[model samples]
Target: MTNNKNQNLLLRSEHVWKVFGDGNEKKTILKDMSMSVHEGEFVAILGPSGSGKSTFLRVLSGLIPPTEGHVYMHEKELQGINNEVSIVFQNFALYPWLTVRKNVALGLLHSTISEEEKEKRITDAIHAIGLKGFDDAFPREISGGMKQRVGFARALVVQPTILMMDEPFSALDVLTAENLRHELLTLWLEKKIPTKTIIMVTHNIDEAVSMADKVCILSSNPGEIRVELEGLPVETRMQKGSDHTELVDSIYQIMTNPKKNPQTILHDGNHIPITLEESPYQVLPQIGISKLKAYIKKLMLQGGKESIRELNTNISLDDLLPLIEMMDILGLGGVEENRLFLTELGDAYAHGNTEEEKQILKKQLIANVSLIQFIMQQLEDGKHTIHTSDVLKHLHAYFPHQDAIIQLKTALTMGIYAGLFSYNRQTGRISLIEN
Candidate 1:
């Protein structure tokens, strides 16, 4: 890690607030958030989905104005799109009809430079991004990794002072993403690119810890900066059992602290309360049922209970927390005294056959998941079918609009897998199965 304590302040946000919609439908995405980035620094904004991580990045790059507060670039107020800032989007944003060289050259279209200078810069940018001979290749002709390289080259050709990336490597395969991450780090360390600062938005905890000099964690549903971790070196993060691991653990603690929010319990028709811990929109399980069953078996093998910290030593908090929460939601497990323990249902599922496991899952989903119960009740009432829009409207009361859509889709998937309901994608409607 480079000592950037004496470096100049490149960008800062003060009491920033971003609100979507209007009147009664309005939702606050970011709230009173303030943070700063320095020159020669690599910063990461880390949070779960719907945490406004990308929205904050857009605000920082001046792609969108905040509903309140202010953003400063080089100590001056940023009013609109900052000419010195550029962004690389997750989808690569490449023109399929244009060749790599043409796409990169587009970055210089508004420049006052001569054609010869533009050609030189374009060639240099392409080469810098490791796309040398493929300059004439179209986006469709190259691999996903190469297309993302074109994205980097396009952003680099403009010679922006700050580069903002919205999960830039998320679209690639694991190996490809890893290669790109290393290549980016090499460029930043070698000073091959003219950009002075890099700000990235990501949900991957390991990615943030491995890449960024500083990490800012955001909480969801009116996102706010929950914590800022600094001075984390790549070397330190890679070293297991180091202080870096402790820092990562601390982050998980902050994110999962039950004290931060109220715990809402869903009730079945029998009026039995089922704990639905974690975020409001996290009604969907992040891991597949098979993986969850395997985790339960592992827990049982290890005496059916383990401290959260001990469990984290093997599995990442990202994977572990969601699985634990899902288990609790299904009445398969619970957390007590900071230890996770499997219940009778969880142990049975862990040892059961595939069909039996599915049965258990079906019963749990119908009983604990409100959306599933609502769909079933609607079907029983002779509705026959429920439009996805209606489900989204109901979910909107609990989650943000986008999150509501995601939760509904996830519920549909789980419901279909459990033989509870069938979703017609073409018609955007869900109907109960003849169980």
Candidate 2:
């Protein structure tokens, strides 16, 4: 759905700065941020909570104006009446007492247009969102998923040129969220609205990868654009496999590693090569599980005395499992009392291929915390310890990622065992330790 003429840049933001409060109390959310989206492109803003993703969207949607910088649509400066923009919020924001039809029609009320036109728009929106049969149902009468559909319908009724969704699917159940995401992807692909542009804000890395043509990752604190990743979101997930595992590992590295640049040595006796500002995924140390397995095999065959831990020290359970699993999968390494040990295959590589193996042994042991922190990040400020389910709900407010929540539960279990917290899985009750 690209605008053929001036399709190069549908939306552009220059040095955007959103500040809150005043005088000494001022807080700058965005700092000198600049980016552009082409017409019909699904661009996603990926960041932790309080990273100013919502602020960016609000300014783009004309709900709030930026304190600094300017935004342009079709190369024209955007001011008040940017009619081509529409938004769907995470809270559903549907009128509880109003039926789906009326809720969707509320957006059209400001227009002087006749009721017939409004009805036609509302009906079309409902049908497009696959909620045709739920037109007469109130928000409470429908399921959470359907209520979100009403929200989408409400936004879609306006038929804006640009669609802004701030974690719109984050309120639904796991299955429902996945279903709605799939539906939206299908709609975007099939409909191909030429004037359409989508800018979605989400904390879920997978969602950004799954639906966006461009994924913009934001840094913390004074939220600023950190990096932009481009790739096609695979329609089907292949868990525990090389392709899938590699992508996940790469993303994890980019998000976690602080000192990303690393020194490297090649087989040609090249010593201390500098890698400047490369995506953590592209660095040799952060190679995928499958590639790591292959490299280990090659190194073992080379047969040289070298410490494996020195080469690869900063590996976490989450990213390291797949690598070890690959060793088991390929029959290259053996497990000894819950530890991974070099087998005949590994011993062979470690002995002979000193330099070549050294190249492969470069490891980035960037310390990363449990995935629970990622979920906790989605929550607003609160002091009380929350149940696992409640924590999951907070996660939904940003990224609707149930899998990450599961990881958080696993982390919580570990934390409990470490005396950091107390938990009972069966009851799902959790309490923080004073220490």
Candidate 3:
């Protein structure tokens, strides 16, 4: 019975390979990847761009079948979209023509249930997603963040046991995205409904480390799982920075080093054994990962979690090194190496040890890094969101500072108030979002 239960895998993929082209020249995006996410576990598949994380997600959700392997849910092989699974994409695939109520109800359109029951489910989903007041609002009229809520609500209305998300917060401004992440975590924790499993694909490492019970790191190409790390929930993780930071460092090592050890692998036949011994970071010029690790630790200790560019500037590194920059930009360190520190926002988030809480906090922090910097820069400039050149002028005021360009640009694009800044893509002028 125990074996049966384990075999009745909530979701399983064996030897999955998604090949795009035909024949011998076939391009394999996801190769020999097999993983099982049990019922009620929140799992995150993380990787850099083009890492096939998204492809893996689509296969698991039954949106696309793997060219090589097989997928099973409930121990029964899945041929198409699993009845127990629902996917939420980064684009928030809400119906522009439909109202929020109708959009959610669409999920159950194929069901034999009556209209009354459908409306009830829709209503419940709306409230669950904090869109009670906006039920009448069309997708076109609402903010990008709110539209995503509708998409989530629609997915939830079907009452799927598993949730598959792909960068759902990628489109929103930092504050709005953070707010959504919190709401989603709260709902997931409250267990108002029966969502037992969540498998999300994200480019954001911090999101993976914070929100997932288990984080699977995929290599850049061929999309293999380089490392799998467990995350403590937000409640438990934040108490000790050293321990958590170390845990993060280990994950960073797994990612930065292309070489994988046997310890990182699952014994299942689905996982591939890549025998490369060289570290990925070694390919780049040396800036000393330990130095960066120390720098970030020191910065976080002092600033908690502040702007990366500001922290880097304060530290006064002679060269604006790319490797360290990449580490922090990826959220492996408290501050992006030589960049920002953990802000008050980050400190509050790092406090959570639970995957759900950490995920929420991670999402919030990553999205807002730019927003916070922008806000701070605005305050320094004695005005709210202004044109890029105007901010550049302020950066120039900090003349002779090596990070003048890096700081100003990051501030403009990253941690600012989204509602307070509007960029005219055509004109190249940035204005504040009207309240």
For model 1, the local distance difference test gives 0.80
As a TM-score, model 3 comes out at 0.61
lDDT of 1 by residue, 1-435 (tens): 343333799899999999999854678899888898999888989887778998999898888999999999999999899999889999999999999999998899899999999999999999888999998899999999999999999999999999899999989998999889988877876788878999999987767876788878776666788767673665564445566665565556545552332112111132212222354434565667667877898999998998777887797766786787788888998876557888999888887887888799899998898777777888778777888888788788887676677677767777888888888889998887885
What are the Cα lDDT values of the candidates?
0.80, 0.62, 0.63
Q: Where is model 2 poorest over a 10-residue stretch in terms of lDDT?
A: 262-271
**TM-score per candidate, in order?**
0.68, 0.59, 0.61
| Backbone-clash count (model 3) | 40
lDDT of 2 by residue, 311-370 (tens): 234543334434554344334454432234676645644453554333322211111232
- Could you give candidate 3's per-residue lDDT for residues 93-113 as a string of tens digits? 877899877788888988778
Question: Which runs in model 2 stand beyond 4 Å of their true positions?
Answer: 1-6, 192-195, 233-245, 259-435
TM-score-based ranking, best first?
A: 1, 3, 2
Model 2, residue 4: C-alpha shift (Å) = 11
> Which wins on TM-score, candidate 1 or candidate 2?
1
Model 2, C-alpha of 111: deviation from truth (Å): 3.2
Error of 1 at 135 (Å): 1.0
User: Which candidate would rank higher by lDDT, 2 or 3?
Assistant: 3
Superposed by TM-score, candidate 2 places the C-alpha of residue 34 at a distance from the truth, in angstroms, of 0.3
